[model samples]
Target: MNTIQDISKFSSQEKTFVTIGTFDGVHFGHQKIIEKLVSDAKNANKKSVLLTFFPHPRMVLQKDSNIELINTIEEKKSLLQKTGLDYLIIHPFSKEFSRMTALEFVRDLLVNQLNISKLIIGYDHHFGKNREGNIVQLTEYSHLYDFVVEEIPAQDIDDVSVSSTKIRRALLSGNLKTANNYLGYHFMLNGNVVNGKQLGGKIGYPTANIDVKEDYKLIPKTGVYVVKSNIDGLETFGMMNIGNRPTVDGNHQTIEVHFFDFNQDLYGKNLTIELLYFLRDEQKFDSISALIHQIKKDEKTARDYIKNNL
Candidate 1:
């Protein structure tokens, strides 16, 4: 799939089939709509185009700073690429752009810029200044611009929003199974490997500390989890700790991964770990030996789960 960072930068005169949304997780419900879009576009001999906004519209228009996203920008792009989409256009969301009227958005961006032949959108979708553009306005604009406006049923689009909410709730509650079910894939954490106190090394369980820089990216409930990552083209299995080192009296939360049968230096390397299962919630052990003992048990449990299920 070709990814366009900005819609204005793309020079295209050919007509296209387009859909517009944040498409945050690209979860199962979103996939349903995208599938119809790609299939219909292919049947009609038109390129499929997805126009999305970065910073999320809420962040820019409503100043929603506390919103957490299921996937980062790169992660969202990676997921969308696997959907057989033709063009993924990520446009910057700003206050100025938010002020554009529904008519202007349809005329300037969709018709003039993208040369849109058809627009596939959610049944209740609203866009443009203060979200004044509903299906009613979209239909009118489609007629004026000589493009088709196909609205996915309310039930289908409602599932997309509902699933997004359920996925976040499931992740924050340590329900990995439910979260993955809603997401249609493993929930992942991507970050750079950073230096740590080396306390796990002393306990015969060396770990790589992950430092996720995106403040908007959601982190799952603090606990231990079974995880997998592809490092240097090789698949590696591991257990990750997403909590403070309470046994050592540490206060700040840290994401640490201990890979099985691997001992290579990983400092400064970026890693994407997919959470497979939730083992247990984090707790403070009585002593160093006690903590080590519990970790060994956790490893065994993780290994068994991986062996039987994976």
Candidate 2:
């Protein structure tokens, strides 16, 4: 798919079938909308365009510094790329942009700028200037602009019992299975491997300490999880821990992964770990030896699960 950062750069003369949303996780519900967008565009001989906004509207409007997103911008783009969209337009979201009136958004942006022949939107979607625009306004604009507006009814769009919010809540509660099922894929954490205190090595379970750069990206609940990653083009299974090392008197949270039967210098390298299963909640063991013993058990459980299910 061709990704355009600036809407003005999209100079395509071909009329487009457009849909707009944050499409945060691109979960099953969002996938249904995308599928219809692509299929409808193809059937109608128009370019499929997905218009998404960056710095999420809430982040800008509410100054919500604590907002955590399920997917980073790059991750969202990567997920949407698999949906057979022709064009992905990522527009910057700002207070000024949000101030545009509903009619200005439809006439200036959608009709004049995008050359949108048809708009496919969710049933309850609202936009423009405090969200004054709704399906009813969109239908009115369609008549004035001589364009078509297809509303994916609430029942159609919500048939799947999945949403980004639900997935986020599930992950925050250590419900990896429910989150993954809703996402239709494993939840991934991408980061660069960094040096740790070498405490795991002393316990015979060396780990790669990961540093996630995106502060807005949500990290799952504190626990040990079964995860997988690619190292030197080989799929590697591992158990990951996300918590403070209470046994070692460590106070800060850390994300560390110990690959089973594999050892390599990964510091300074990037790793994308996909969470497969929730092994157990992180515990404050009585002693270092006890913690090590539990880790061994976690490793065996991860190995068995990977063997049978992977």
Candidate 3:
């Protein structure tokens, strides 16, 4: 896949089939639209292009406050590239860009810059200043621009719209099962392993500590989870925790994973963790023995869940 970060480097073509969206998670619903883009482009003998924005529109509009993301830029690119699209156009969203009218946006960016032949969008997808462009405006422009327009219906399962918001909510609530189903894969977190106080080691469950560097990335509620950790190319089953070590009076919340039946030094390395199940809520144990007993049970549950399902 070719990534076009600047509009100047777009290299206008005779025709291209394109869709535009932020596509945060690139969830199953987004995949359906992308699959259509691919098929439509192939059928029309044109390049398949995805026009997405960086920093998310909300971040630019809201400035200081914005909800965290489901995937980072690197993660989004990786996922989108796997769908076999021809081109990925990343527009740097800004205040000036946000001010463009629907017609100006279509004429200058979509038509004039990229030379889109057929535009595909979701049923409720809107664009331009203040979301002024809707399907009606697109239809009107189709006649003038001499391009075709296709609207993909909103995807839903059992009347529930499959959306990024819903998936994020599920993840935040520690409902990994529902989140995974919507995402069409495991809910994953990528981070760098960092040094910790070795509290887990003292309790016989050594953990690999990870710290994520992201301004707007969602962190799940404090709990024990059945997780699969990827170190280099090796995959290991583990139980991960996202919370403060309450028993030891540790105040900072951290992400730590203890691999099942495995011991290895993973400090300073990057790792990806996939959450499979939510075991129990975080608690403050009365004593060290009580904490250890609860951890043992959590480990057993994680092990059993992974063995049976993962």
Candidate 4:
């Protein structure tokens, strides 16, 4: 998909079909909406476009206090691009922009700027200050602006509505199975390998330290997880520990990954850690030997899990 960061660059293309939202996780529900949008746009011989925000509007409007983001800007762009949409419009959300009224947002953005011939939105979507725009308001504006407005109804699986918030909660609580089911894929984090104190090496289990992106990202609660690490395009089963080394007397938390049967140095390289299952909570060990023994057990458990599942 063509990522349009600035509204001024949104040139007049074929008749546009658009949907506007944060699209944080791009979960299964979001995928369903995008699929329908693509289908409708194709039938109408129009370009399918997605309208989303960068840094998330809430981050700007709420000052420094913002909820944890499920996906980064680049991650969102990459995921949306996989949908085969014609355009992905990223609005640089700001306080001034958020002040616009609901009608102003639709009139100026959708109708005037994008020249939207058809608009699609989630069933319970809201926009503008105080989130005043509803399906009723959207329909009313469509009548006045001479455009089509469509709302995709809520999607449910096993009676549970799929949502980004729900998936985030599940992931934070270390329910990887449920979170993956909701996300339609394993939740993943990609980061550059960085040098760290050689504590793991001292203990005879070397690890690669991954530095996660700070903005638009939140680490799950400190724990151990069974993960698939993609290094140089090869996937390896691994066990990851994310937490402060409480037992080892370390002060800062870390994301350290040890790939099973991998011996090459990955320092300075990028690694994508795909979380597959949660093994256990982070805990303080009684001694270094105890920790080493537990790590061995975790490795065996991770290997078995991957062999049976992956």
Candidate 5:
């Protein structure tokens, strides 16, 4: 799929079938809409276009700095690419763009700029200047613009029984199974391995400290999780800890993964860890020896789970 960062760069003369949304997680519900967009466009011999916004409209318009997203912009693009879309347009969301009136958005952008022939949208979707444009307004404007508006009814959308909000909630609450069920894939954490204090090494459980650069990415609840990663084309299992080391009097939270039966220098390597199961909540042990004993048990449990499941 061709990805266009700017809408103006889309100079295709072919009329397009378009759908617009943040499409945050690209969960099952969003997939249903995308499937229809691709299939219908193919059947009609038109180009399928997905117009999404960056920085999230809420982040700009509502000044919501604390809002966590299920997928980063790059992750969303990677997921959407698998849906067979002809074009994916990621428009920047800003205060000025949010001020555009509903009429200007439809007439100036959709009709004149995009050359959109048909718009496939959710049933309750609203947009443009305080979200004044609804399905009713879209239908009215389609007549003036000489295009079509197809609103996927609420029942059709709810058939998937999933939403970005639900996925976020599941992850935040350590309900990985429910979140993965809705996502149709395991939740992942991508980051670069960084040097640590060597505390784990002293305890005979060295770990690779990961630094996730995206501030808005939603991290799962603080706990020990069974995770897997591909190291040089080999699938490796690991146990990950996501919490402050209260026993060691550590102050800040850290994400550290100790790969099972694998030893290599990973200080500068990038890794993607996929969470498979929630092992247990992090706790402070009374002594270093106590913590080491628990770590041994956690390792065995993680290994057994991976062996049985995989």
Candidate 6:
């Protein structure tokens, strides 16, 4: 997939089939929409273009909403890349861009700029100034613009029974299995490895500190989790701790990962850790030895799960 950062800078002579949304998690429901879009575009001999936005509409319109996204913008792009899309246009979303009326957005951007021959949108999709546009408006515009508008019906969407919001809630509540099932894949954290206080090293469980740069990216419920990562093309299983060092009277939450049977320098490498299972909630142990003992038990549990399920 060719990713274009700014939609304004994109100009194509070939006609295109398009879909527009935030596409936050790129979950199974979203995947079905993209699959249809790509398939339809190919059947019509037109290019498939997914017009998603950065900063998300909520982040721009609802500043006090305190919205935490399931996937960062980069993560969303990576997930969409597997769908065989022709183009992924990540337009900058702002108050000014949101002010474009429904007709203007359709005629100017979709009809003229994107050269959209067909447009696919999910049910209840809204656009334009104050989100006044709806499926009815889109159909009307399509007739005037001489294009086709397809709305994935309410029944179709409801059948999937999954949404980004629900998935976020599931993760926040420590329901990893339900969240992953809804997502049709493992929920992941994308971050760079950084140096830590070396507390894990002292406990005989050296860890790599993960620095997730996206502030809006959602972190799962604080606990110990079984995780896996592909490091330099090798699958590595590990246990991750997401909590403060309560035993040591530490105050801030940290994400530290310790891989099993693998030792290599990862101080500065970017990594994507996929959460496989939740072991237990983080708690304050009586002493460092107690903490270390619990960690050993967690490691055994993780290895057993990895052995049987993975």
State model 2's lDDT.
0.90
Report, for every candidate in turn, its global Cα lDDT versus the true structure: 0.90, 0.90, 0.89, 0.87, 0.89, 0.91
Lowest-scoring 10 consecutive residues by lDDT in candidate 5? 153-162
Better of 1 and 2 by TM-score: 2
Q: Candidates' TM-scores?
A: 0.94, 0.96, 0.97, 0.97, 0.94, 0.96
User: Compared with the true structure, what per-residue lDDT tens digits does model 2 show for residues 115-138?
Assistant: 999999865788999999998999
lDDT of 1 by residue, 1-310 (tens): 9999999987677889999988877887678779989999999998999999998887776664677899999999999989999999999999999999999999999999999999998657889999999899999989888999999873333344445767888899999997887788999999999999998999999999999999889999999999999999999999999998888967898999999999999999999999999999998988999999999999999999999999
Report the Cα lDDT for candidate 5.
0.89
What are the RMSD figures for all models against the true structure?
A: 2.1, 1.7, 1.2, 1.2, 2.0, 1.6
Clashing pairs in 6: none
**Model 4: colliding residue pairs:** none
Off by over 4 Å in 6: 154-160
User: For candidate 4, what is the total of clashing residue pairs?
Assistant: 0
Q: Which has the higher TM-score value, candidate number 1 or candidate number 6?
A: 6
The sequence of per-residue lDDT tens digits that candidate 4 reaches over residues 193-257 is 99989799898788999998755686786899998876777878888899998888769989999
**Position 205, candidate 2: lDDT:** 92
Pick by TM-score: 3 or 5, better one:
3
- Number of backbone-clashing residue pairs for each candidate, in the order shown: 0, 0, 0, 0, 0, 0
Candidate 1, superposed: residue stretches over 4 Å from native = 154-162
lDDT of 1 at 188: 97
Instruction: Identify the runs in model 4 with alpha carbons over 4 angstroms from their true place.
Output: none
Which of 4 and 5 is ahead in TM-score? 4
lDDT string for model 6 (1-310, tens) is: 9999998888999999999998888987788889899999999888999999989999999999989999998788889998999999999999999899988999899998999899999878999999999999999999998999888753233455778888999999999998898888999998999999988888899999999998899999999999999999999999999988788867888999999998898999999999999999988988888888999999999999999999
